[model samples]
Target: MDSSLVMIGLTNVLSFNNIACILGGTLLGLFVGAMPGLSATMALALLLPLTFSFDPATGLSMLASLYVGASYGGSIAAILLRTPGTPSAAATVLDGFPLSQQGRAGEALGVSLFASFFGGLMSGIALLTAAPLLGTLVLEFGPVELFAIAVLGITIIGSLAQGSVISGLLSGGLGLLLSTVGMDLTTGTPRMTFDQINLFGGIDFTVALIGLFSVPQALTLIENSHQGGKVASRITDRLMPRWSTIKQLMPNILRSSGIGIVVGLIPGTGGDTASWFAYNEAKRFAKDKSRFGKGEVAGVAAPEAANNAVVGGALIPTIALGIPGSSSTAILLGALMVQGILPGPNLLTDYGDVTYTLIWAVILANIALLVVGLAFTKMSVSVTKIPDGFIACAILTLCIIGAFAINNSLFDVGLMLGFGLFGYWMSKAGVSPAPMVIGLILGPVMETSFQQSMLIGNDSFGVFLESPIATVLLILALLSILQATPFFRWLRVPFKRRLKPD
Candidate 1:
């Protein structure tokens, strides 16, 4: 990295116009993310078109700020209303709402905000340093390796199912099937379009995301409208935690942040996965595990830090390899393409200044999140006070608008509604939508890479197993599958017993 180039990028990020854009974007993100049925990805998708009018640096910075802010903002609703504003904050609801009910809403919010800030700061540092190194490493990867990695990601996610692993696999298989609905990329022949032109382009991801995540929540809200008062009372304490409490939770925050960064670096995984993994790890390692899910401050800190940290980590692959680590970063990649910037190895070499500026923007966004988030904590509590019916109607309206806005097509709107109904049913069946989402995103990559690898190897199946990286990834995938089985759990019990000291 050139020192002069780095300084130039920092200078650009610190400019008044760029700072204003970041601030504005962060504020918008906080509002959107604090509302149930809205997600960071949907927010970015809706906002991407507006960035076309701005300079590249300003536009990208704004998106980065929004990503950072939304990652943290989800906790507000999760804490106050027992509903996560974003899927990434789902784990936060386990402890956050408990704390709110205990009349410690301020304490939970403060810890969440601070942990989010710290995690994002650490991830920004990781993005600044680790991305370049990882970029070089990925240079050694072939299509076979990439395909293997995608398979590994899907396997890991499916195996981590909170309910039946079969259900998770079934959901993932369904997504993979849906991913094949469009025309074949290689043959240019329709597979499952059924004569619909819109189907030729495949289902729009944003439409599916909105329908799957937002619609179900809206329906839930509407169904529960008659039974609810405000989930919690007004919050009226300081919005910052005491220094002593911060010091005590620092270790858990740091550990969870590390977990989040690793998860975020893997393409197809997102903050939701990171938060759940962090929450589980925190519970496993805590001295007082009994406190978890009953308003343990550490419980709130773990997921908040992990989810926020995902913002910077997810950006790493998006910037360096053109592989989006999560849905929000996928939208950021779209924003880059709209600005005529192509991501991959050439991104750093041809657009070093812009790349570095985006990295710096991540750091700046976290700082702004800390400042702006604390300022709004008191006011945001009022969100829970809104009537459930009113909230449901507002969200349904936004969902309609957002779905239609993607391509200005009523067909997309219909698709969203159909998927929304499907999603609601899936939820009712106790199946998670996360594995399906991962399968949907990675299915194309895996298919394309596998075909390309076969072509490169003259139709030889051994090509996939030949690469050392691919081999290792496949082994890990196998292990992940085995780990999800009851037999593996039984086997592990004895090993754990043997390892324990008498």
Candidate 2:
């Protein structure tokens, strides 16, 4: 990165408006994450439409702060209710609730808070260092290479998704099909508009995100409202852990943070995977594994640290290569495109002021996480008190208003509701909507790049094969998909023999 760009970023983040947004976002995230059902992704999706009114840097910084805060806040419900507030907090419940039952709630909360801060801080530093280097390397890519990158993204995300690879790929395909809804760019004729003027420009990505994430979540919360006993535990002891305890766990925290950063670099994996991976590593490294689920502080520290670390780790590819590292980053990338900032390698140079500000915001947001988390960790239980039925109603109302607010079009609102129902159905079918959203985001880029590459290659199909980067990426995409196939074991037979000989 350039010194000038760093200076520009410093100024952008230091502004009063941006600082307020970051702090406010952090508070909101804490509240949302303390609830048992809401996720950082859903919070981000619901709040995305509101960001359009602000400067891109401020809005993005706010969202980044929210991401950092929510990652930590999820640990609260895990400790108190024995239920994870978010999927990423699932591992924390293994030890966190045990501590609460043993009257060490404060100790567990303190460990979680400190671990989250340390992990997020380290990941932010890694993001600051890694994204620019990767950006420079990718700046050489042409339309052919960009198209290849898109193909690689789609395949990798699909293959690694939580369900069957076929389902993932189908979701991605559906998103690509939906992305073609607007008028054709090359020809003035509409492609999939179905004679609706609202579809002329295209489906609003923000509208779709709000509907897909928020509505289903609200509906689920309503369905599960019959369950009770969500009383929050009170923090009676001092919130901070002893310095000796911190020293003892520093190694575990550092190792888990590293694990988080690496896991987050992958496109399909998210904090949930990183947290579980870290928790297992902690157990494996412990002298007495039997203590892991019995109110062990290391168990609490590992998962919280790893999950919060994912914030900065996931942003690297999103900022550097325009390929979202996780679902949360996918929304952030969508917000960028919605704000008229094109996604690609030049994010460091062409949009340095905004991009660099976002980087700085992640670092600062971690710091803010430490301060806000310490002060309000106990007080956040108030948020959990709100009834699920009320939350569902609020979510539905907000989704409708936000969808309409995008273009003041009732058709968009109806479309959002349609996607909401579709999202709910997908959840029942065990399909993740993230891959679909990613495909939707990447579709236009892939199409435009392919068309441009063809034009550059004199309308020859051989153009795709001309670039080495494109060729390598296309091969990787093929390998990614093939690895999920039934014949992959057969394909690995030769490698197995070679490894055995070695």
On TM-score, the leading prediction is: 2
Off by over 4 Å in 2: 489-502
Show model 1 residue runs off by greater than 4 Å: 1-18, 32-63, 77-108, 240-256, 259-303, 313-358, 500-502
For candidate 2, write residues 252-363 as lDDT tens digits. Answer: 9999999999999988999999999999999999999999888999999999999998888989988888888888898998889978987776688789989999999999
Q: Score candidate 2 by TM-score against the native.
A: 0.97
User: lDDT value for candidate 1?
Assistant: 0.82
Q: List the residue pairs that clash in candidate 1.
A: none
TM-scores of the candidates are: 0.81, 0.97
Give the Å error, residue 246, model 2.
1.0
